[model samples]
Target: MSERILALMGPTASGKSSLAERLAERFDGELISVDSVLVYRGLSIGAAKPDYPHHLVHLRDPVDPYTAADFARDAKRCMKEIIARGRRPILVGGSMLYFRALIHGLDDIPSIDPAIRTAIENEAREVGWPALHRELAQVDPASAAQLHPNHSQRICRALEVYRGTGVPLSSWQLGEAISQADQFECIALCTEPRAALHRRIECRLDGMFAEGLIDEVRALMARGDCHSDLPAIRAVGYRQVWAYLQGEVDLPTCREKALVATRQLAKRQLTWLRSWPDLTWMNTDDAGRLIQVDKTAIEPVKTDENNEIAAVEPVWADRIESLMRNF
Candidate 1:
């Protein structure tokens, strides 16, 4: 039999991890996280780190960089091992770029000159990231649209790619990627209604705070090595809480900002999904029922007592099995 993989993608608080765990149990699969934030060792509560065995989580210190390229390499290795063990490899999380690099190979851009990045950093210090974001918009609107004005790292990387190679990062991303569409036999997105998803987002943020998200950020800051500039520190909830700890914002303000940031993150994740090719869309309910959504309608996945492991679950296995058949 050929190697077949399952990719479960979704926006934040969409119950992806829970659903993935169920699917893994039913399908003889191992879990591999696609989250950028969860790759860091200390990002638990804020990252919404799952309480199950998942490969590629906590693989690095927050201060160290973990690029999409790094994830692609690591994930492929993990998938190969899992398949060799006669189990399925289930890729799950919201990090679209990592998914993209895994399903479609990364572009091999020429080595970037260190001086180009230094120059970009110098320019950013003088005029702030938003200003540089404006510049990026002028030259590479496709990349700029996906990035927030304050997302300094990506903004700088896009500009550096443009300056060094005279090619937009977005353009380079499309160049000659060896597609792994065949290996990723099933790519399903778990989503819900906008209002429902937003409500869940609010609850998720509140729960994180209640679970000592601030204290987690405080401890990371106490490490003295971790700071706002690090990607791990700059992750969604952590970034806002860190600012609050730095006296840049009050607690309420930090909560507000974190909520907004998470919503924006969800929007971007959905945006990526909407345009994705060969995607199977699955909308989930609060009870984690697997519902099929079409371009024109929402169709509930049929389930019965014999199929369900719990409340409307084994239908997920059936639905995913159906999706795999199509490939």
Candidate 2:
């Protein structure tokens, strides 16, 4: 088994892909992306998927369903294969749910009946999600407390779980966590500065537009497999661009909405990074620091590689106590 695995994580456009590529080349590793949108075939520009070959990417059609569970499964397979080939595996991307699923594992969730889901949807439409959220507070206040009123999908899923099994969603989530996040030995890296990440996101969105994001959305729509409800089309920039293509908003308005949405996504990512355990924090803004850190980190790898049939590999553990101090 390969002893060295690195989970390179950061918010979108935080130079994660570039850093992962550099490390992968230096260490002879394969890249595995953990993104939901990147799984769909036609979401390249909007998703910002790497141009190079990577695992768990472009494996599904636009309409084919995917979940974090699916990602965890495929990622495990990819990692195993990479290890068997005598190379390191570098997990990359910013999808928090996929990372959580991979680390914490998932429970056997209750399946919602179609009729029940439809009924809940109708009620939400009539009374609004916030009102329905209040009702959820009555039945399952614990789950409701953790979820936002505007998060209709999760709120509805929780209600559906309760309606189907007469059990709180929170109970199932707690009871069935795989609890194997700590078993995997890997290096976790994260960047800082929410303002810098926000700026990077804005620039990426602009680049996506310049790369014909509307044309890409148009092509996907032409395929007739995607719509506003599908996860692929609902992805940050894709949603706004699809709206613009449908004549609902102008190009500039679409760009602005997408930028705002991306910023919100960055904020959520930063929150998750702050709570993540055992991560190496580095200022990505400092190229000199990166060069020095890389130099300091490379000797362990060189020593490990020099020994054939090595019994043990040293884990280069670096914990910056104040990993998210800037955030």
Top TM-score prediction, candidate number: 1
Residue-level lDDT tens digits of model 2 in 1-327: 324456767667767777677766755678999788999998899999788778988999988889887998898888888878877777888887688677767678757688988999999989999998888899898778755686677788889988998988766655233346644433433333456667677777888889888899999999875788788888889999999999999988999999988887766665565555665443455221232224244212111263221232233323211111111
Which residue runs of candidate 1 sit more than 4 Å off their true CA positions?
175-179, 186-191, 286-317, 322-327
Predicted candidate 1 versus true structure: per-residue lDDT over 1-327, tens digit per residue: 256677888788887787678767766789999999999998999999888899999999998899999999999899888878978788999999998888876788899999999999999999999999999999999999888898899999999999999999898787333345666754444444577888888988999999999999999999988878899988999999999999999999999999999999998887787667776565577544544422223323222464321222223335465553442
Which window of ten consecutive residues has the lowest lDDT sum in model 2? 318-327
- lDDT (C-alpha, whole model) for all candidates: 0.81, 0.71
TM-score of 1: 0.87
C-alpha lDDT of candidate 1 relative to the true structure:
0.81
